[model samples]
Every structure is written in structure tokens, then in C-alpha cells.
Target: MSATAAPPRAAGRPRRTSVVRTELRRGVGPWAGAAVAVTLLVTMYAKAPAWQGRWTDATDTLHIATALLAGPLTLAAGCWQGGRDRRRGTLELLRSVPRGRLRRTLLAVAPSALWPVAGQLLATTVCLLATWPYVGGGRPYLELVAADAVALASLGTLGHLVGLLVPWRLTAPLLAVAGYVGLAVGTYTESPARWLSPAVEHASPWEEPVWWFAPASAVWTGGLALAALLAYAARPARLRLLALLPLAAAVAAAVPVLRLPAEGPWRPDPETTRLVCDDGAPGVCVNALDRALLPDISQALAPLNERLRGLPGAPARWVGGANAPGAGEIGLPDHTMDAVRGRLRNPDLYLNSAVQWLFSDICDSGGVTEADAERLADVHLAVSEWLAPTPEDYGVPVGPGAQRHLDALRAGSPAAQRDYLARYLVADRCDPEEVPVP
Candidate 1:
């Protein structure tokens, strides 16, 4: 003790800060923080281009990145760190120290609990910065970032609990594998029960952007972490039952989210859905999420719009939601932010496919007969050829049948082909066979 400092109030009763500091010293020795950092870097490295080249949407990228980097790997690290004292024959010594087991365990798990979250947040900060230029046009959804962080922290704490209970050498790796598989399968399933899993849900149109759903996951996971902490810390058999209160609370909070039909924690963002129009006719408007893509999308669509000018049944105003009231409204390309690669793999081609959807009598589905299926396919092919003449245009694909029809259309007078396209587009129903592939 320093010469000026007073003695402790009682033996075994060290200052609270000193206790936490001691735990940090012990927990950090295992290099848990470094492990978290390394895991994040290794995982995000492969998707480096996603930060700028493709997905450029910071929040969207974080959603997937957290799923892969934040939780499972940190859990593995936590498992190893939690068991260190026991493995080194220090647990009983630590327990004998002057302090309640609750305070001691809390201090001990703090580093294990926090390093993973710190790593996630740090990596996320880097990714979020890349979206700065897009800030005015569209903002990243950060609620998801917080939710995922809570989930990772919970996993970290739970891993520690597992380690204390099972001190085997293989515990760390097994927990890591289990964590990854649980998250992967939980996200993959359509079941609502699995919806309670820590990963972010897939973004969907049916679900609007609602704030509560995101944090509810945090509430649920945070409860689990706290419960695990209490159960592991307390020596009295009855105190462990108190852990059930938080667990029950967690289930209560998760019910509303799990009951949701689609994979969701979102509802529509009206501000996001608010249309931002491009310069002129045939007019094009994009939703806020895709607003940054508008400049490029507008430029890409220019040739198509120019060809469509002054034609009957051609779209007058292009709306992005993919719903056209009549021939006057066309659905401009809305880039779906799937978890994969953070963006559609091929924007132009996917957009071209949207155009094909617009012209179809059925618009891409419904129990159709064999003859109708063949017919609709032919009509879609012809429409696709007309809209995107070259498959090379921004990666738009032209199938064999479509390419043959496109070649035939190109051979004909431009006026005649345009007239054919105009008629085909507005048709309520055409037997696909009735519509010439050419």
C-alpha cells in the first residue's frame, strides 16, 4: 500500500475497483482481446470490397459481419479465459478472497464480457465510415448494430459460464463450433422459434423498419447473460432459481418478435421509402435506401428511357417499389440488400429481370399450367431481349432463346421492334406461345 493510503476496512475486503482491476489482469493474460481482434479482422478481410465496392451500406454490412465475427469466435475465447483460474489452480484462491462471489465473478467476467463487444464496435466503426459519402442520400440502420453487440456480449458471458461448469480442454473449440452452428442454422430456418437466435434477421419488404424489434433482441440476450452470471456466481442452491426470473423475462420479450410471420425486426421506413426523383422524363424515382444508387441507376437507365420516349403504353413515371398503377408507372430497380455480399451480386442483370417482371401478365408466379408456363417463359424471354438487347450491358444475361429473339428484333426496323414491345408490354394476357419469341 502507498504510504499515504489508508488500510482496507477489513481483511478480504479490497476496494471494488481493485477487484475488477485484478480480474482484468487475469482475464487479459489469455489474450482474449487480441483473439477477438484477430477473429474480426480475419473474417472481415475476405469481404473487404463490401465496405466500398459493392454493399457500401454500412449497417447492412455490419449485420452480416457481426453474425460471422462477433459472437462465435468471442465465445471460444471466453471459454478459454473463464477456465484459466481453475486450470491454473487459482479458482479456490480467488473464491477465498474477501468479497462476495457475485462481485468477484462479475469482475472476472467483465473483460471476457466486454472484449468481444469492443472488437465488434471497433471493426464496425471502420465499416460505418465508408458510408459517409452516402449519408445525405441514405443513412445506415444502427439499431441492428447495437442489437448484435448485445448478442455477442451475451455469448461471451455464456461461454464463461460453460467454461466454469465444464473445464475440459476441448470445451473452447466445442463451444465455438456450437455457437457457429446455432447462429447459422437459427438464421437459416423459417421457424419463429429459431427467430430468437442472436443473428440479425434477413431484411424483407413485408416487414417495416420498426425500432423496438431490434432492441428486443438485446433485451432478450442481455437477460440470458445476466442469468448465466448469477447462476455461476452464487453458491446457495436457491439463488440459482432467481436466475429464472431474468430468463423468463427474456422469453417474454422475445415472444412478440418470434410471433412475427416473416424474418423481421423491421417495418418500412417511410422516410427511407420517400421517393427522390431523378432529373427528367420518363421520370425515375428511388426509395431512400437506394437513393445513393440513384445517380448510377439513372445513368444506367438513360438509354432504355430514351428509346421508350413518346411511345404508347411506355412508363411515364418510374416508381421504385415495383408496383405500377397502370402503364404510366414502371418499377425502377430497387437493390435488395440480402445478407450475401451485402448487395445483389449483379445490379444491372437483376434490374433487367425486374423489367421482365413488369411486362409479364402474371408478374413472376402463380400456379400455372404447363402450356402457360412455357408460354410465359417465351414472353418473358422476348421482353427481356427487347429491354436489354445486349447481355453484356451491366451484366444483364440473355438466354439462348432470348438471344435468338433479340437478334431477330435487331434485324427488324427499330420502329417495328418498338411497336412490338409496346404492344407486348401492355397486354393483359398473352399465351406465351402466342407472343413471338422474336
Candidate 2:
């Protein structure tokens, strides 16, 4: 037996990675990826200050940029890629290959479906890194970024299928426009269905998304894309029934999303909402997210703190976040508007905010006559002005009467000013009649 029959050469499957690499090189994949990256970078760069020092703002901005700008671009690129075989008269040649139709379709779609996701991930990495040095608390939401990537891949796959079905030359551009309009309208809708769209806005940077939202969103978008691909590409008609599996998964995932509250997936983030206080007679406290800004905030409010020191009914603490002001505490105004790069953009404006909060308790104007209401309002204005003069360009309406009262209060000795503030602090603002006339 001249041979233990030389071991038969094993048949090997073509290397999937090699095929993908080839497709990426020859197809529009790199261009698509580059376009997405450039788009995201440009948009984020334009609004750098808005998201620079906050993790929530950074992630939310990236999500928005991906959905609004990169999503349509990916769809267009996928559509163009899908139509290439037919346009080049290679569809028949592709069909003649020994590979199964589904396998062939997947290989052809590799470039279109994967590139945009890669681009998004790349952009996300860059942004999170940029935000790392600036942010004070709370980690980036990596799951949300992953969910966005999945959504982009799904969009690309869907666009590819659409291109295969529609032979029109303008299909790619038209589809892109439609995708943009649909996503834009979804973002503005009051209906809960807007949550299904990946472009939903997140207004509150202090809130964290629920744990399950990112996974559910991934399933919803990914399932639909997979089901559509199987339905269109499966060779045997019976195998198309397998599409039901992912379609069902998509429907199941959609139910919870549709039932989500108007706030979408977010809840108060404890870490971000937790208070970090500075040592003072009347301690100054800000949320942990703004912990780095504590010294700045404490310094800004120093003058007001001195004026209220040891006065009855004066706030024992100045606190921020959702914490309710207690018997001897006053709620701090949202400092986000006044802060930039971990410091107050305008300390005067911030001081003005604290002064406004000091007088924010609702007064039962119902008991006060119109003329008295007007007078109390003027006195309130004067007190506010004396504490923190509204920046001249800040646009607050300051009447001459309030101006005169403010000047009088300012010209008084420190002891007299303290005595007046002590009485004013204890007066029941609700009873406008009891409010001290400044």
C-alpha cells in the first residue's frame, strides 16, 4: 500500500476576513467611514464648549450628531454600494458563484453595513477622551454609544436592501433626504414613538439612562435589520420563515420603548446629583458633577454669605441639584448657564442667580392689592439689586424707584445694612404687607 493514501487534502472555506478586506478596499467603505468621522468631528468641534466639561452633554451631543448627520450619509453610501452590482452588469456573475445567495449577499454588504458603525465608534472614542480631562464626575455612557453604532449599522443594511429593489439612479440621494426628514420629525414629535428613533434629544445632563434602554434599543434596531436581510437574501423560500425570529424580537423590544415615559430612558443620576459642599458658616454646596467648580462658586457667593451670616431665617446652606431647600437652606440656581470649563463664565451673573433664589419663595399675591403688589415687587427688585446688581447688559427691567432704593441701601453703613437684612430675612414674603420696604 504505497500509500496510506496520502491524507486527503481537506476542503477549506474561503477566509471571510480576506473577502471583507477586499470588499472594503475596492468598495466605498473607507469613503463612507471617513465621511461619517469628518461629519461628527466637525459638528462636535463647532459646539465644543457646550459639551467639553460634562460627560452627559458629550455623549448626548455625539448621539445627536450620529443620528442626524452621519445616519443619512451612511444610508446614502449603502444604497450606492447595493446598486453597484446591477449598475455594473455583474449581478448575473455574482449569482453564478458557488457560494449561497445569503453568503454572497452578506459578503457584498460587509463594506456598507460595517463601515458606518466603525466610524461612529471611532468618533465616540475621540470625543470621550476629549471630555475626560474636563469632566469632574460621572462616567461616559458606553452602552448608549454602542446602541448608536447598532442603529447606524441597521440603517445601512436597510438602505442596502432598498437600493437592490429600486433601480432608479437617484434612489440613493432621495432615500438620504427622506431618512433625514423622518429622523428630524421623529425628534420633534410628542408621541412616545419618537423613542424608537435613535435621534431622540436628551435635555437634562444630570440624568442617566435606565440600564435596559441601550440593550433594548440595540435589539429593536438590529433585529429588524437582520430579519430584513434574511427575508431578502435566503435562497430557499422556506428558510425565509426564519425571518420571523428576529421580527418577533424587534416587536418585543419595541413594546417597552413605546411605553417609556416622556423623559425617554433617563433617571436622576445619584452621583451627579450628590452634593459636594465647601466649609463655611453657611456652607456652599454644588452637585458632585460640578465639584471642581465649588471653590469658584463659594468665592462668588462670599459677599452674599457674609451679609446673611448669623441672620434669622437666613439659609444655613446654599445647595444645588434636586435637593429641596430645607428650613434653613436655599436652593442654588442651575449653574450650568454661568459656567464654562469648570469656572464661572460670569461670577456677577451667577451671584445674581443666587440672589434671585433667595427671594424665589412664592408670595400669596392674592392677599395683596394691585398697588401693594407693585410696591412689594419694587422692594423685592431693590433688595435683589442691592445684593447683586443685575449686569447692565443682562436685560433685567430695573425701574427708577428700585434703583433709588438700591442706591440708598448700598450707601448705608455695613451695620445698618445688616440690621435691615435681618428684619427682611425674617418677614413672611407670602404676606406682601409684612415684607420690609427696602
Candidate 3:
């Protein structure tokens, strides 16, 4: 090599690649890869089943898991790398390196960012695969993946910055964990803390983007990045505070532009109600008060009169006045009377399940008799059958488990109904007739 010859450049430009390599050497911790694999497996197990059914419900779980796992890990990695100079008492040595302070800082922190990027990529891939079978074209998946990637990158960057700024070894991990918790809580509470967390925007085809880049979140992340850069520069105290400008601007921007809704009582909106009615499985409807409330004999069946015109008949109409009360009799019709009001007085059946309580209430009140209950049951059964095709013997097949449920209502004891529900309603897979898991 000639004396005073300039270092060979890649593409005729002095290569920054070595800096990246150095950053990787210093920033990529020993445990990062192991943590990534563990996180991937856990996320896949939790999210892959969304394709089986209850797609929304399953995706929600995935969203939460991604945030919790990725968020804290990002912060931890950044903090670990940030403390290196202090731990080694090599801040002066680091300053002596032959590069601009900002460039050197970038190089030092760049490697740590790699792990978070990889982790986010893995999460996005898993989520896509889980959702792809159900989504038609690639557009929806692409949109979701793109949004997720941006959101996660911003989050990782923010965590990395915090790790650099905070000098305390133990305090960084605690802050990371606390930040994760606080962001989660803010989703439910709409508190100021939520501003710090990245808003994962998993938009479905029918819905609009959900805060893909909220101003506060963006500002916080950007501010963190700038602060880390300045810290690397070893800027004076006067300039250190300037690192906060982006964050302040972010908060200011969000105040008017973001306008997140306050947390409060949630009355069912028209769209939600329509979604429920349109998509609800036969015999399965969304209750305003609860996600899984189903209609049983007590709510609709018990209120009708036995003498109503269409007892045991199609398009049945009520003939007797509801005003004229009748005795609460139990069991099927007699030879003389075509229809009779039967009471479900089996206390054991009545107490074990929510459905039983509903049935008992109807029977106890001068509500509908057995004939009235039967008519309503039949209508629901027919609707359910049309919606979810199953075996005829089990009753109208409404999805996978509706038939079994209707059968239980027909002959199984209350205990049997409860046990039957446990099989699919709350278990690993969708019951078809079952509501979403809480």
C-alpha cells in the first residue's frame, strides 16, 4: 500500500459497514437469539389458531403478546448496550475513536437495534401466516404487516434511546417492564402513560387504520433517537435538554391532532350491533351487556300463553290473553289437551348453569308454558340450522356445536348442558355455536 494512501472505499465511498459490524459486535447480547426463539414459539402457539375461527378474538391475543414481549426486550437490549461505556469506564476512550460523535454513537447503538428488527419481523410473519388462510388477497396482509413493522421499529428505537439515556443498570429493566405495563393499562384507562407505547395498527379490510402513528408515540420515539445521538456526541448540558424538543413537539402535535377518545361506558354502537346480527351464528347472538349471553327458555319462552294460536304449529300465533293467568303445570301434553304449560322444576338442572336460571325464571313466572317455550326453541333451532349446517338428529345444525347444544336443551339435564358447553364453547377450538372466548 502506498504511504498516506486513503483507505479503500466501497462503491468509491468510505464504508460505514465496518461501523455497523462493530456495533453488532458490541450491541448484540449473548442471550438475544435465545430470547427471540422462545418469544417466537410462544407467540405462534398463542396466535396461529385464529384461522380455526374466532379470528378477531385470536388476533387480539396476538397483538397483546407482541407488545408485551417485543417492547420490554427492546428496552432491555438498548439499556444493556448503553451502559457498556460506563461499565468499562471507557467513555473517554470511546470519544477518542476516529469518527464524528454522532456517527460513532450511531455505530455503537446500531447492532442492538438488529435484534428488535428481527424479533418484529418474526412476529409479523407469524401473525400474517395465522391470518392469511382466512384473508382473501394479499392486500390485507401486506397492509397489516407494513403497519406492524413500522410500529415495532419505532418502539424498538424508543426503547433503545431510553436504555442509553438512563445510566442505572437495574433501573432500566424496571422502567422497561413498568413502561410495558403502563402502556397496556393505558389502553383500558386512556391515561397519559399510553402515549409512550407504540400503537399497533392491525387494520382489517372493513376498518380504518388504528393510530398507525399517533403523534405522541412518534414524537417520543423520535426524541429518544435524537437524545441517544446527542449523548453519543457528548454534547454540553445546554444541548442535552434540546434532545427533548422532539418529544415536546410530539405531545403538542397529539393534543389537537390525535384526540383519542376517553375511556367510559361502552354502549353498543349501530355497527357493532349489525356486525353481531349479521355474523352471529344461528341460535347465537351478541348480548349488549355481555359477549356470550345466549337466549334460553326463561327469557323468551316463559312469557307466552299456552293457548296461543300456533302451539305446536308453524307461524304460531297466541290466542289466549297474557292477562288471564294459568297454573304452572310441569311436563308434556295430555291426551285431551293438545298443548300445555310445563314448568322445569328440576332444581338440580336449574341451579348449575346460567341457561338453567333463565329457564327456571320463565317457568316460575306465569311466563310462557312448555308449548310457548317449544315454539321459540323451534324458531331458534331452524335459524341456527340454516346458519350452521350440522347433523339433523342433533337438532338444526348451526355451525359445529349448535346441534349438541340444542340437543342438551331438548333432553340433557342442566349439568349435562354445562358439561357439554365446556367441550367446545370455552375450550381450545371454536364450537361454531359458542361465543368468543373472553
Candidate 4:
């Protein structure tokens, strides 16, 4: 029985799971994760109203928070962790271990690289869950979130390497501050290179990111980090040449990012931007992303719509988005400002917005004299105020003359008011001569 040939066992390989558990237990791993979670949750709590009911807003806010706050914290934490072996005077012992230098470095770097990402993912899950019920359409951008996690891990690894190379204790804090400043500056730059920074801001809530952008960003940041690790941790000097492969990959990934427009990676999202209309005479159409708010918006605009319904030249549709208003359509003001948790916070304020949208066309002041412009402005204000009275708390400036006109319009019989509105709707606002008096 060949003495029951013992199962061939690998010589000195440590169990990966045991090593990972030990790494996570010791060092800054657990603390870093807790700090990141606490910081993100607190920041998101303070700004909850801005993103509570909107998927795009929620994701964008999370991205910004990760890039600005969590990222720096991770870098500092990684730097602190990297210096641990040196601080404990275990560098010689680590060097003398049978494990390969690269393996040792990777094991040591694990806590720094993985903890921050885990924390961010946890925070992201909480935020997305909170936003789920309130949001009507459009899914959260998980790809972008994944890319942000990769960027955090890359920053952590780089900070770890810096910690190993730089002996000073102050390097962590200084690096964190520098990282924040660099990210903030990149956000404001006009150059396309700003896209390379993980902190790029997205201004349009209706837009989705380009399909390839997130993957490219992950590759760009991850490749650079891997390259650095290979160059530094490889045993023989000749093996360091292998770092060039990842370095080349990083450069290749950066090309498309560098070629991106100043607006970064976003493109118009047809699904989110598609119009979802109510069944009213002068239909109210909000973007699909805000479809849940349609009932509230329609109710808020009901009075104005009642007045405009069946009138000549009145808008056939009150449409929200970048779409140009056609012959029988008018652009709707952004309703997101008036909404809180998918409900209208102030209906009167929203009504005022609709009234303003009815007159948003800019007339060439160049053609009109100052006095005419002032008169036109007052008449416009009176008409607007009559259509939808400004909320008292808004502190809207109303001149005595405009107030008198508004009062008169309100005091008039329904027939008279309707007659005046009929003429006003057909008037070309750009021409002072064409505008009807209130």
C-alpha cells in the first residue's frame, strides 16, 4: 500500500483567508472603514434634501463626497498603515520571511487598499436604498460608483507606497491635504484633463454617463496603481521592467479620457429625458425621471392651465427638459427645486415658476428705450403676479404701480380677465408695440 502516499502539500503557503482576516483585524483597516462610513453618512445627512428623491442627484452627490472627503481619508489612513512595519522595527523580519517580497507587500497593502472601498460601497448601498422609494424613474449609476471605489483603492495603494518611501510621520496629513486640493482644482478646470481626476462634477441631472467612461476610468487609475506596486515590490531589478506593461495600459486608458469634452463623460439620457404628459387640456409634461411629481405639478399649474385652456396661442403642452418649445408648447421651469422627497414643497412657488416660464423669452433691450423697457417689465410683472401670486415669504420686489395693476386684474370680472389674457397670449413679448396692457 505504498505507505498511503501522503497528499502532496504545498510547502509554506499561508492560507489567504487567514492572512486577510489578520490584516483586517490589525492595523488601520477597521478604523479606516468606520471613519469613511461615518464621514460619508454624516455628509449625506446634511445634504439629504438635495438628493433624497433623485437617483442622478444621489449618485452625483455620493461621487463628489467620495472623491473629496473619503478619498483623502483613505490616502492618509493608507499612509499611516504603510509606515506600521517600519514603526514597529519589523522591516528586517519581513525581509527575511520565505514569502516573496511582492506577496508580502500585497498582504501588507491589503488593509489600506480594500477597507476604504468596502466602506464606500457600504455607504453607497445605504444612500441608494434611501433614495429608492422616492425616485420614480432612472436607475442609479452603479458603474460610476464602481469606478469611484477603484479610484479610492488606487489612491490608498499609492499612499501606502508613499508611506513606505517617505519616513516622516507628517507625510500622511500633508498628502491628504494635497490630495483634496488637487481634486478640488481639477473640478474647476476647463481642460479635458480634468476628467482624469475622479472628482469631476456632473451638472446635468437628466444626462447619463457615456458607456465606456467608467471602465476607462477604472483602468486608468487601477493600471497606474498596479504599475507602481510591480515596480516597487518586484524582487530583482530586472523584474521591475514588467511594470512597463501596466504603465502602458494606464497610458492607453488615459487617451480617451483626455479626448473627452469639458463636460466630462455625460450624454443626454433619452429615457430620463423622455416626456411623460398628464391628460389635462394644456398637458403638463415632466421628464420621466420626475414622473412621480407630475400629479403635484399638474395640480400646482391647474389654475394657470384653467385660464390658458382653449385660448388661442396658449401652450398646448407645458414640457420640461431641453427640448425647444414648438408652436403650441412652452418650456417648464425646473420643478426639482420646488420638490422635496418627490412632493411639491410649495405649490404657490411652483405656480409662480410656471408663470415665469410663460414669459422667459428675452426681448432685445437694444431695440427698446429704457422707459419702454421699464414699462414693459412692470406690465409683465403685473401679468405674472395676477396669473400666480408670489408667495409672501419669497420677498419678491413689487413696485406700487405693478401692485395696482395686479389688484385691478384680480378685481376684474372673469370675462374681462379672460379677454385680457387672450390678447396677452398672442402678443409677441419681444416687440413692446405688440404687447397688450394689463
lDDT of 4 by residue, 1-438 (tens): 477898766879667798878977779988998899889999999999889988999999999999999999999999999998898889999899788999999999999999999999999999999999999899899999999999999999999999998889999999999999998998788889989899988867789999999999999999999999999999888999999998999899999999987677888899988889899989988888998899999999999999999999888999886566777788888866778889999999989988998888777778689878877888889999888989999847899878877888999999999999999888897788988776
Better of 2 and 4 by TM-score: 4
The CA root-mean-square deviation of candidate 2, after full C-alpha superposition on the true structure, stands at 3.2
Candidate 2: stretches off by over 4 Å: 1-16, 188-191, 261-263, 364-374, 395-398, 430-433
Give the winner by lDDT: 1 or 3: 1
Output the better candidate (1/2) by lDDT.
2
Residue 241 lDDT (model 2)? 94
Model 3, span 1-438: residue lDDT tens: 889999766685545676576567664543553465468557667544332222333344445555667667766666776777777788789778777666676666665556665666665566555654543121232433343344455555555556656777785678678867765665653454443455432323122234433333445455555554564455555666666675566556456434554421112233322312112111122312112212222223222222111222111111111112123222211111111112222322222222222122222324445654444454344323322333343332353344454554557564653444333222322122233211
Off by over 4 Å in 3: 1-14, 29-34, 51-60, 136-169, 190-196, 199-206, 210-220, 224-245, 256-258, 262-438
- On TM-score, the leading prediction is 4
In angstroms, the error of model 4 at 180 is 1.4
Candidate 1 structure quality by residue, lDDT tens digits, 1-438: 689998659986667678666666675523666666566666666655545432324466566667766677788878888887889998888878787888777777787888777877777776666546434344555777788888888888888878878989999998888888888887777777666776645544323456677778888999989987887787677888888988898888888977886635555556555777887678778666555566666666676777777777678877775233445686655555421323345545655655654564544445567767765675566666667543474444656665666677778898888777777655555454345445
Name the weakest run of 10 consecutive residues (lDDT summed) in model 1: 335-344
Alpha-carbon deviation at 142 in model 2, angstroms: 0.7
Q: Local distance difference test, per candidate?
A: 0.68, 0.88, 0.44, 0.90
- How far is 311's C-alpha from truth in model 4 (Å)? 1.2
291, model 3: CA deviation in Å? 22
